[model samples]
Target chain A: MTGGYMGRILFVNLSTGEIREEVLEENICRDFIGGYGIGARIIYDRQAAGVDPLGPDNTLGLITGPLTGTPATTGTRYQAVGKSPLTGGWGDANSGGFFGPYLKFAGYDAVFFNGIAEKPVYLFVDNGKAELRDASHIWGKDTYETEDTLKAELGRGVEIACIGPASEKLSLISGIITRRGAAAARSGLGAVMGSKKLKAVAVRGNQKVPVADKERADRLRSEQIAEMRTPVAGGQSFIERFHKYGTSSGAHRSALSGDTPVKNWGGIGVVDFPEPDSLGGDNAIANLAGRAGCWRCPIACEGRLKEGTGEYRYPAGTRRVEYETQASFGTMCLNNNIESVNMANHICNSYGLDTISAGCTIAFAIECYENGLITRADTDGIEMTWGNHQAIVAMTEKLAKREGFGDVLADGVKVAAGKIGRGAEQYAVHIGGQELGMHDPKLISPRRPSQPSAARYQADATPGRHTQGFGPSGFRGHFLNAAGLCMMGQMAADPTKYLVGFMSAVTGWECTMDELLKAGERIANMRHVFNLREGINPIEWQVHPRITGNPPQEEGPLAGVTADIKAQVYWNLGALDWDMITAKPSRRKLLELGLDDIARELWP
Target chain B: MTSRGSCGLKPDSHRLNTSWYEGSRRGQEWKYCPMFRCVVGVFGLPREVTELREVEIELEDGARLRDIIAALRREIPALEGDIICAGEDRLTDNYAFNINGRFYQDENELQVRPGDRVALLLLASGG
Candidate 1:
């Protein structure tokens, strides 16, 4: 097992079908020098802090870094992580094909998983043998017919990853799906892999990684791929208008920079399209079937869209759809039909959903069906209209077959606005159940000194409207998913000119992006002590009180944009979101947030 | 068959063609139709006839789309970029040219003739 950067660490439990192995532990790969810092130090060291992300005492954590599965341009993604059941926070998610460098050349860098499995199984590795068998006919399939019936019953060099039946019926806006519509989506972690009754994995290894000094890490990876393939500092006319209209060629540049998020937020025009750049510019050149990349990625923003089938039927395969499910289900739920957002990203990757909280809770049930608060007898008779792309692909298959009222919208938008109340939680454009991630931070208006809500939701925690330290107060400090960089090269570098030269080059460890932003402030205060040991303190956060102390969205160009959340609580916002300005903090935000062992497990 | 930039057998990018990134990365070098790039740079094949469907390369009859953009600006001096008119008048046209179909996306919207089935595109920006 020579793979220099790591050797193994596979685990797997499927409730005792047992298969273990650990080895690769050089002080956990020299202080987390891997993508997402060694999966947040293996879930903050075997998570105790009230686990239950989808119970079976949660654990998924998948990982793979040292530029996992190599050729590290976009460092072969990987991630997966756990503790999320939609916004219990601290759930990680990452993806890219070539199944994370074929699980780090079959000699894993991580894998974990745990309990709950008496039936419907499936694990099957190749190089370093693994089993877990019998998936009672691919457990209610649909992650694109279980990756085409397991490469047609395990034939042509396999590589899989699965979850559907809304993560085997654990849907809090589930996710996982690989290949047929790529997605390790976010947060809901496919209801933490259907609370662990796990059903699909399939790796294939081959080895040959070892290269601590393979000619000086291939000459610092060919000088960071010749400074990320030249043409910069002048915005390659915004990266060739983003690889010629991919990233839903910015749904008409985010509704012409009013930063699109209509319907549910209650307004913003264009009912039935013609221009949002002519239906998001010919839906980015008709599902552009040209590029693809993941393992050893080179910003090959993996787009490969073949017309699904005549009469323009896109979403068959060669998946990739990013840019927040192309602006959370294209044009923030107004649907400028890119073949109905490629058939709502193939019914959320064939039913393993999470198209940004299923397109922000289907634009909050079409604003509670245009405010009669759910009619057509709570929508079973469909007519939740507003640019109906065939009733948003028959309500994402009745919100992933939870059927009628899509079982209160697969229970998202804060338990479907606490089981459909008429105030309709003042327009459920979600917060706590992870939705706002597609940049509608009310259109980037920040100057920061304190960060007073940087625009809004000042502090209604929901891991969704994230970015607490408000993007390291405009660049020089940068935090947007640290260690997992690229908010498009943090909109072109400066997180203090590359966080101390990207931590003294990966991890020969020499800190200073203010001490590697104290490990992203001890991984965001150990995910707020794992969501205050699952009690979710600070008065159990949740938002959309028409967005705390309102101002933004009253009508586009961020009508009246507000929230300067007390300039990040009188400038001491420190270690970003430090449980929002002291119920008790300071010790220089915990020794500049080395976060004394997560403040001694969140104050003992 | 017309192996240019992604090794031209082009049967729908013929099953993930990775003969290690197709022969020294696009050398059968570049250029096309400037008198068939000096006959495919001394004969490698830009034409033994390379049509894989979608024909209609203008000039076959009563021409005039500016006389086939002046005979493809005298056979591809990068035809000064732009052209489209591919199937379905590319939804309400300026003859759909912000390129990105097969090449020429700088704007100068390439005009065509000789019977015009012109599919190749570019002029692209945001969707």
Candidate 2:
């Protein structure tokens, strides 16, 4: 491989303590690119159908893209892929930090783990050398402590991705934590790591990722940087704002515009929480101590909050809680305290819980409590009340520890509701067992019944994720993720134009826009196939009524808006070349992407 | 251009000055006598506008935020009708504007002057 990849895949069988290195085929690299694409293809080929997601039969992949370790802006990201315990289908999550770059530097494009270990252990990769070390002392520690301890034992420069108590407890909402706050926080992949008895992956590398053409790579990089600095149509620069306020800058406005789902997707913004500015980016910036960015990224959107003197004081190194976390903990819980939200963020990060799922689960509990379905008797003597920051904080701790009612909620809303009975399931706002992200479908009108609506992506094989394939931009996002570039970097310039240049220069392959989009679509459909093989009927997956405007609000920004989910799904099936009735990819479409084997197996 | 009004006031009551006559020719220079000035905070302009983050310009007696935007478009040229509409009726959905701390989707009729802060907010992707 000329430009982007290290051309090596490390396969480790934890059950037998065997490690093997396999060369990544050039054809596969050219067709799939890297990141999610490589991970999805490997999982589909190696893992058997219907393997228990938390069992040893499931394979866990940690992979980076060709551009990961290069000087490319926002290129430091890695993708984690495995069968999701939450959705029972294809699951993958990506995060930005130093891990991806370091992983590539350690002389491998991807690492796959199979079988369960006899005891807790962590994978240590130093340059080209690899081994599994005993992690008994750090097994029960939180992610922050585990990272610190591992770094102390193996130099400060070594980057680590580790699980916390939530994962160890087998919570379906658990995620792998990296660089303090950066998280592959969706799909419960952390539970897979726990099942394998793998606590962390530590890497330190000194090798440079070979660039195909130095002159062309430098030219493309400089041009892209200059273009990123240029202002766009609306007197605003994506790079500038992202650097200043990160994503939190839009929290207040999004709340006003009905983007942030208020009160567990059951309430409207204006009617439920009128004064949302208190939790906006400006206020978050007011408490900022400094900025923390991923490797080689100029736009340092990660904020470090100042340590407070009182009860809600966050530690100095605490990353600023993002809009999604803020909305989930603040407006979704009816709590307007930004500091409390920050505290909740810290809890989720340290304990390795997905904030969206955790907040939504807690909200479901409150709704159940309000409806008298459950009382303090069900809540371990803690009063689950709306706007009760203290109770919210206490419940989060319990969820991480899997104690009392927290244990019930740890499995996520759908399962928790099923356990409680008494019509409590009606309060659970989720799709296929995964909690929905903060975005409300009703707020933004769907252009087509099946025009890549938010509801459709939420109901996809990897259910309840906001970042799954949605539209052209969504497809581009997938491609960028494959190339190991952050989505934020995509906002600065059109990926179809600029990213292609970077890819061609780095990989020495004349990549076309159509090829890139096709690769992205192939990766998505392959994941869908993973679900279909596992007995998931995509069309049968339900979208929550609250999100579809089943009971329309009397007043608000999205008063009469309802997402036509049936039409939306049908539209999506047609657009993606999937069988409308069965929700499987058409055999013809699979063949087009060079997945003849998949087509034959699926259709036959 | 002839100076209209000039008076140094207390710090608390300080205001900008404008001396442009009605129907003044385009590109005509005006004197600042004593009036109000509006400060447009370009906190998050799109990448096309370069590195500009803040701009201060003298305000007409009945100038609205739209007029200030128009004056800015004239000054930057690259900003013409890209940020604010040519009619100053509405802003593109990609950008949000705040007048004295109040966010507005349509502020064509909203008045402004010097000392008042107009903040431009960017609502792109990422976070």
Candidate 3:
């Protein structure tokens, strides 16, 4: 083993209660690096194509990268990978908290789960000794209560990744909630865990993560931290801003700049929501009770909001609403109330729902009501008007519990639109089945004829994610995620040069930017193969007309600017060496990336 | 000294088109001097410079946004090479400037006026 890895992968069969450990091959480690790359590769090789995403045949892999728990800045990240119940394709969601480092300390690189359990159970990995324990008492609880009960039962130091009532009920937008309010929130992977009757994964370990060279590792970490402290071209250093205001700091400005989507991507920012600054970073900071950071992260961008006094009152220790959550619940609903946004965030965290999808679905319902497609009778007598915070809160509960009309939206915006029928599909602003994130593609300049890179990023196999890292400067996310670094940290301190140095120190591989980016491209192609083999062709997938600027906004900063999606996809395919017509990675390109078998499988 | 086309206004006058006075100080002849003044608000500054959140700047008429940024940089040296480029050509990606609630992608072409509210905002990306 070079360094930075436990070199062990634990495989557990829930149906038969069989547990086994396999030594991680060094070649695979070197090629895939770790995290989602390793998880994607394993799932692709093991999972048969076209299996039901929520069936017993599907596998769930929780993985950590090389830099995780190794003194790397923002290294506390783990990826949950499986077939997405929402997208029905290659799905993965990454999160940060103490759980990943604890898993690493427990002496395992990854945990792979297959088959369905006969009863609700939780996995406990204690210093590498793993077992399944009955979780009948904790089955129906929310994530917060579940974590508290588990900690009381299994000691305070144990870290957990648990699903809430939403996941337990098989809500497709549910996510895995971890400690310090970190969530692997996307792709409906949490529901996959629920499908297997797995309630939580609790880990406690004292073993140290092995490092190749401690002195070199320490040096690299200090250098990166020091660089982070210095202000770059911006007047404020990213570290300082994060430490002070967190990610929601830009919410006010982003609303004005056409970055945050408003009213389900159908309304103009200034017109639909006036005084947007009320929901921005300043207001979020004002309500901050404290700040929290992921393991080994110095920025501590996670803000903790104070509990409110009356109707909006939530538990005081809840994490601050992130930018996406704020945009989703705030501008997307035509509501500028930060308190409501904060409460909505708390509800989603406790219930384990993807705030982006939930907010978008609610916006769709509101639009449906406005268009006279749905009435008060359809909304269970609650008026689905724009900016109705009460209705949003009420609908969120119903959705989490799958109660009444909430069951219609429990499957997500795509299925919900299909069921709603009369012109509701046009109201659903999503790419593929996943709801679009806050950023508008119209805000980004197209490199060529009206083709915005932002739109292309959203059109990837795992559609509707803003963080797919496909912008002109977004290639860095692939390397950053591979190395277990946070995107925020990368933005603050340029990861291009620092990641190369850090990788060399940890892996003793003398890594370079070119090699790191090549690995990223390889991982991306490998994921694309996973989708292709499962019959997901990116070329044929629909990009919502609203996102493509179909009619174009009549007024606003983005007026008359349409993202030429076809041209954009064509440009993206050419850049990635994918066949434009087939949307498949070229056999030559795959072979060059050392994916010879994948190339053959794709070609032959 | 030549009193060529002297407007009846003092040199220190804050008026928009105040004519020149004391022409002997420089070799070049002075005429009507059109000046543009505006308030610039700089947000997210460190605690040490928190009091310098807003500042008033005056510039020659027809001054582009770059000139206003240059003036601000000169006034607040700490802001130099931070949000504003060292050469004052454009804002760095880390920061964005908003004029009257509108975002200016190309600062070079933006023109400032006396009553314009130009805000220097720190650019933040998502988690």
Candidate 4:
């Protein structure tokens, strides 16, 4: 038996209503680790290429990493993997919450689902048993209501990851929501689940994930926690502001510094959205009802807002707005009404949609409206003007429900641009098909062609993603995700010191940094191979001119800076042994990473 | 303080006049030249790294960017080896240095005026 894995994978064919359990191979667990690493390997082998992302042929897996249920610090992560309807390529997104650990406790390391059910159904895995149940009663409910209803029926401890009405409508930007807030909200994978008529997966388990060296793992965890608690010699205590404000702590500063994209990648922050301190970190937690966090996470970087008392009324225990949501809704749209942004956050959370994509799409629509490509007639008489907080909130709800103009934008900027025609696509800023993250590439390192952020966005299997690193740094991030570790926790604790150490202790493998990095590289290559097999080469893709700073900004902090994103992609592709022109991994590099099967398949 | 590029030292950056040092030696104290005072804004670094929100640093006339790094290190020792390499002009990949709002990388010889605002922003990506 594998020490960290559940030794079992549950496969459910929704159309056939057949449920089967297969023993997970120890070698697969060791080589791929877990989370999307395992998901990628399995999907690349089992799922065929050129299949419709929303069709019965597409396989969607809710998979967890080895350390997910273990006592490892911040080990609450799982990956939702399948072909993306949005990007039409390899897709995977990770989320941190109680659902991942509880899924493992439900006696499976992963669950793969395919085929559309005859009716709406939710998969219930209680202890060692699994079955599909009719979900007709909760079919059209929001994520929160669905979770509440399920928890009332099944014991309260039953953790669930479910889609909302948005997904039921097959909105391409919809995401799976858990704990009423945490979401696996990328790659448009929730639409895949919705397409299968699968509403939710509720899990409750007591099974212990076997650890090779439980004592050593516990000891290492304690040591790391202590290290995190210890303050630096001369400076203030670390993690204080993060614990207090979460990611929101950097919102105002990041915007001012040109890190956060402003005016949908057009306007400058200090010039257009100055004095956004009301939407800053301090203000974000001001109305907090309490703090929240993922399973067993000590940092508890999440803030839950009290029910809104003033303008925008939301339910209590609403998820506090995060930096990305704020930047997307606040700076991108030039709307600084904190309450409206909070209301928008609540709307997105309830409707199970991606805030980054939803907010960015709104900003894109606003830009289109300003350019005369779209007008009030197209927007159902809404002004759709920049900084119109009321319009922003109204449009967000419409987007969630796919009503009126929102129907045109429900799929995201790329699709919306395609439908809008009349040169509206020029204002629709996106990398690949997905809307770009809040961080701007031009601000990353404008002077250097080998900028880190732009390189990742342009070169990774998943385009327009942030936080994932480039080269060895990226390998480490992949390994961390595969191991079910939180990136923020590792970053706060210093990954170099704790990541490999925790891996060795948990798996009883003498895992070194180099070995794990290689594993990460392997996982990265596997995802890239999946994309390549589907004929999606990011190398030939043209990035948006505004994102690349083609003409460069004229004013504010990032004035006169142009980022050569193509050069950055080339630099990263070279470092990763991917062809600069074809964007395929070299056969020798694949063999070096022990992907002999993939090498033979590609070469043959 | 005046902004960067306002001080006319870019053309003769390499040829240090040493007049300021000579003035000091002659018992003339360092004058408050607006060109020599840089307002440093520190954000995104963990509190354990620095509690300094903003700092105003005074440098001698004709001071290179390295001199400012040295001064910052002296003020915040916790920055040594992690944010800024110890006794080196190079900085770790953890943060980016923005001189008067323009992103600058590996430009140690760049001249700084007194009113320039140097922002040390943590390199953050993702949500």
Winning model by lDDT: 4
Ranked by DockQ, the better of candidates 3 and 4 is: 4
What C-alpha lDDT do the candidate models reach, one value each?
0.56, 0.77, 0.78, 0.82
User: Candidate 4's residue-wise lDDT over B1-127, tens digit each?
Assistant: 2222112222334322223332233466755433355666664442225655556665666787777677667656778877888777667665667775467657878888766657776555435
Model 2 chain A poorest 10 in a row by lDDT:
A443-452
Instruction: Say which prediction, candidate 3 or candidate 4, comes out ahead on TM-score.
Output: 4
Per-residue lDDT tens digits for candidate 2, residues A1-604, read 6778888889999999899999999887877778878888888888889899999899999999888978666788999999999988888888998999999888889999999999999999999889999999999999999999999999867999999989998999999999887899889999999999999999988888988876887777777777777776455666677777887876555665556777888876666776777887688778888887889887777888888656776677888888788888888888877888888899899889899899999888888998899999989999988888888888988988899989999988999999999999888998888998777765332122233555455655678877776533356667888888887666676666678877887888889988888877777777778888889986787777887887665554454455666766666667777887787788898999899999899899
Whose TM-score is higher: candidate 2's or candidate 3's? 3
Q: Model 3's CAPRI class? A: incorrect
TM-score of 1: 0.34
Worst 10 residues of 1 chain A by lDDT: A442-451
* Full candidate order by lDDT, most accurate first: 4, 3, 2, 1
Q: Evaluate every candidate with DockQ and list the scores.
A: 0.03, 0.07, 0.12, 0.22
**Per-residue alpha-carbon lDDT of candidate 2 for residues B1-127, written as tens digits (9 for 90 to 100):** 1112222222222333333333324556654444465555553233225344355566656666566555655555555465556654456565655554345555566777656556554433324
lDDT tens digits, residue span A269-339, model 1: 33223245544545555656687555554555556777676443645463545556666666666766666
Q: Model 2 chain B, poorest ten-residue lDDT window?
A: B1-10
The predicted structure with the larger lDDT, 1 or 3, is 3
